[model samples]
Target chain A: MRRPDHQTTTLTAEAVLAPYLREQAASFLRGLRLQREHSAPADAGTQRADEAARALRHAARRISGTLHTFRGALEPVWADQLRAELAWLSGTLAREHAYATRLGRLLDALHQLSGASLPAARPPSGEGASETDKERAALGVGAARAGALLERRLTLARTRAHSAALQALGSSRFHAVADAVALLASEVPLSPSAAEPAGLVLHAPAELAEQRMLDAVAALPPDEAVEPYNEAHDALWHQARQLLRLHRYAHELLRGAPDPALVGPGHALDLHRDAAEAAAAASAAARTPRIAPATAYALGVLHADQRHEVEAARGVFRETWPHAAAVTAS
Target chain B: MRRPDHQTTTLTAEAVLAPYLREQAASFLRGLRLQREHSAPADAGTQRADEAARALRHAARRISGTLHTFRGALEPVWADQLRAELAWLSGTLAREHAYATRLGRLLDALHQLSGASLPAARPPSGEGASETDKERAALGVGAARAGALLERRLTLARTRAHSAALQALGSSRFHAVADAVALLASEVPLSPSAAEPAGLVLHAPAELAEQRMLDAVAALPPDEAVEPYNEAHDALWHQARQLLRLHRYAHELLRGAPDPALVGPGHALDLHRDAAEAAAAASAAARTPRIAPATAYALGVLHADQRHEVEAARGVFRETWPHAAAVTAS
Candidate 1:
């Protein structure tokens, strides 16, 4: 890795991205340290770890996304390898969180059906006591058992994800990635193209990101987004969410911050992703062999709840996109 | 209060209804005794009380609905007064349960948005640690506070309802109602028409109940039931739910049990009622003055979730209604 002349750097791609990369690298390292220090059994410590995880995940996404978007300005081989490693790291960290989220969603939905708001409160009434008898009388007999089944499955999945994430964090490969990031904080491996003017280097990709997102948004069938929500459309909407995210990240790279026009739609997309994934988890849980009809019925209801969430998110996106598009165009 | 001669009793409306009234009165008394004996501080005792409440409520609904349905065969003044007292008793008992149910629903929805499935688990993390940092990072800043605020308001409401229910149970009016029920167990106050044949007295009213329910079901706009769930339709669906319940009760009186054909649609209506009510609670919570934007956002998501639930329930009802109607017609 050779450095461009200090005077030349002021006008080159290296000048703009070197600082951004360095900041993300530092945040990643700092998150690793904080996560280790805050790994206590208390709720506070777990929260700190989760926060550290978020910081780490955020930095990883920005670095990986930037590397891809700016590959022309960087050493191609090194950028590809680093991007792959960041992807691996992000995936590992996110797995347990995904399971936890899905479990929380399913259990909350079950509680909704059972009319048992406080499952922790062991009602003195025996059998079917989690809810008021009125609720139980209406909700039928499968809620408690359904909840227990979902809990058992999801808890196991989360625990396994936790173990896998821990294993990855401790692996030699993770350490290698960490070492590479540390070195990059001080010296980025740049290509001959890195000497190009910053705007000339970044503008094409930024525009492409925006165009791709707009195309996806335009492709969504406005007609199907409402009544009789089709699951098939969920994939298309999820792609739009991904594209919007890429566009936001590209804006951050080119403009030093995400586009203000993108924020509202970004939030709606995040909701769409969470809800769609939650609905899938509920559907999976509903398929447990030999489960009680009541349990199946409750899971069906839960699945429907998430699907509605998916539609609701889509509704928000539809409402927000026109305004966002106008703002962006202007 | 009078009994017809033994030979004529077999053919009279009183012959058919007296046994039903006696059985309900006995169950109500039994429920009262169980509730008093089991009113301990433990979860089990609370559950016992809840069950007793259910039994009492069930008996009251049955007796009250029966009186209304069979008013032609019963003494009007006595029937109306007793029905009014039963309504009072049922309302008092149901109020606490309703609040508890609504609170549970809101709390669960909050938990769903927060991504905190196990709120009881005081994780090592502090502050926003109720959810995975990933969830908090995505859900925005208002979730914990929103949850706290909703919990406070709903908890207070539930407590007040509990107090009112307790006060009602201890009132002299409750004792008077109980005395009337006990007397009815042995002797029903009958109009001269009570001597009419059982089929002549009960069949027309039972048929009327079924007709009303059918008409309401027919009035529902199938087009609005899917995406873009309109809240205005919720009240109409709720009315349908009530009518269905009345129809089921009428069937029980004529057929010795609820019409088997009605069971599937009945469950769907129950779901519709629950989801519609939950959506309203979520909307109300969202309107709390001076709440943070994040809190409001979360509530908006929750309200949407419940609305989806309402639609889901409607979907169920729609799917089941045709089959139920076919079976009932057969």
Candidate 2:
């Protein structure tokens, strides 16, 4: 009787699968980035260039954050690869020689290119120049020679920085990050629509019926706990009878010449024997413990009152009352 | 000079440790639930008893969902445990006998004690009997029976539904749906006053001053292609300069008692030597086959405007141009 449609089933399957797919896509993209070249310099000026590198580093950090957050959404198989790529990038940035060079070169260039020229002579008398001027002049000449020596060093540092940045761009990390962004962009729009299928399948009329029963029970006075319990108990009994009837109906429908595989080995035969035994047991149990009206009311009160002994009351109902009813009816 | 504070380090360590700890806690809680008596039903009237059982099952389902979402945010390690618990619950619910008997017994007891008796026999047609009376009698018995059966079946069905819900609560899936929520719940928040010792050490002005010479040359724009070969050449040269400066600074700081072990052995020493060589080579390269300033400017323009042959321009800059003015000054 509870026939779920294929669409509902498929939707459930998709819901289960979506996370895996997303993770896979993200990892693949990260790997692709690591294998490619895509570093963007911040600016042309030395100060700005350093700023640019800093900005790029900041960007890398942001990407790592995004990857971390998105890691869960990705498929399990893909998550490992993505995590590896992200970890590499983060580690590289933390201690990369090239990054150090780039930052250093930018700072050095800014210092050199942003000031007025000084003559290689005695300290000139200027408003800002004094005893420190003589000291600074000597330092400047020494610094100039040192700067010349450092020129070769600066060139190397710039080269290394550029190389590292390029290497990072070319790595798989880039592609994975890109892919994740794309997936997020595409899939987000479809979420509202995609939710409909699962909603439809899980929508059962039984929920409304159960709700009504609960509301009726809840409306009873707090002191009249037994009444609520009785109502709830009767409601549940009614539900059991309905299930039994439905099970019987299903059994009847499938009884004749059922496929051996469908029923399993001797399962059908066992079921018939079990049914008879259950009926007899029910009749026998019904004979010994007849539930008086007062006891039922008391049980209901205990249940409604949320008594600690509610479980004991339920046990009495389950073990005693069903058998009594069957014996009395027979 | 680069002294990182203990508190910052500790916080960073805590950030890394939080997820693992939370995952362990969730796993332990779930294990507690799986233990026999913790989640078992209490005895009571069949109907009220069924309600209690249903309530317990619902509670378990809620707990499972919480654990699952927690696993996604805090730790992937517990994913297996969460999955296993859900699978077990699902398999149990799929079987009819598991929940049906317990529900049925509870319901039967309620009916016997409620004093809501059914008619024993059909009466002959009488003056009081109308079409509605016959309809009520026919429907009443059937309705009561259906209600009893439904009570038991609904609990099982709902449990199954809950299992399905749990299966669908994948980490990636939930994150994709609500990333901010996941981060807030899972990510360890850094205090506003948390010390950034690493940042302080790296950005120290004194450290920047010591490396000013190398920094200047690095600011030079590349004149050749930005391909890996050229980039690597530039990067190697840049790294050489940075290494040289760092070595010199370290030597100055350590004085004569510099630790050879700190300098590293074999390949690391060779790398330091090679970096020096590379820096020298980049400087030598900068002196020859220099691109005309106009050409260098044109390349810069192309990179900024057309974004074409940017790599080639970078290559030219690396090959020509004695370290840029910025490197010497900054």
Q: Point to the candidate with the largest lDDT.
A: 1
Score every model by TM-score.
0.50, 0.19
lDDT by candidate, in order shown: 0.69, 0.33
* lDDT tens digits, residue span B1-330, model 1: 232224332566777777777888889888877865665435322777889988988888888888888888888999999999999988987877777777787677666655444223233224323223433443434457666877887778877777787777789999999899989888888888777887677667776877778888887766544343355455567778877888777667655677667788789888777776776665556546555544544554555567676777788778777644623622
How do the residues A29-63 of candidate 2 rate in per-residue lDDT, one tens digit apiece? 44334333223443322454444444444434433
Give the worst 10-residue stretch by lDDT in candidate 2 chain B: B298-307
Q: State the lDDT of candidate 1 residue by residue for A1-330, as single tens digits.
A: 222223322566887778778988899889877865764335322777889888888988888888887788889999999999999988988888788878787777666656544323233234323223433433334557767877898889887887787788789999999999898888889988777887677666767777888888887766544332244455667678877887777667656667776677789888888887776665556556565544544554455567677777777877777644634622
Scored by Cα lDDT, where does model 1 land? 0.69
Q: What's the C-alpha lDDT at position A164 in model 2?
A: 68
DockQ-derived CAPRI band for the predicted complex in model 1: incorrect
- Could you give the CAPRI-style class of model 2? incorrect
The lDDT, on a scale of 0 to 1, for candidate 2 is 0.33
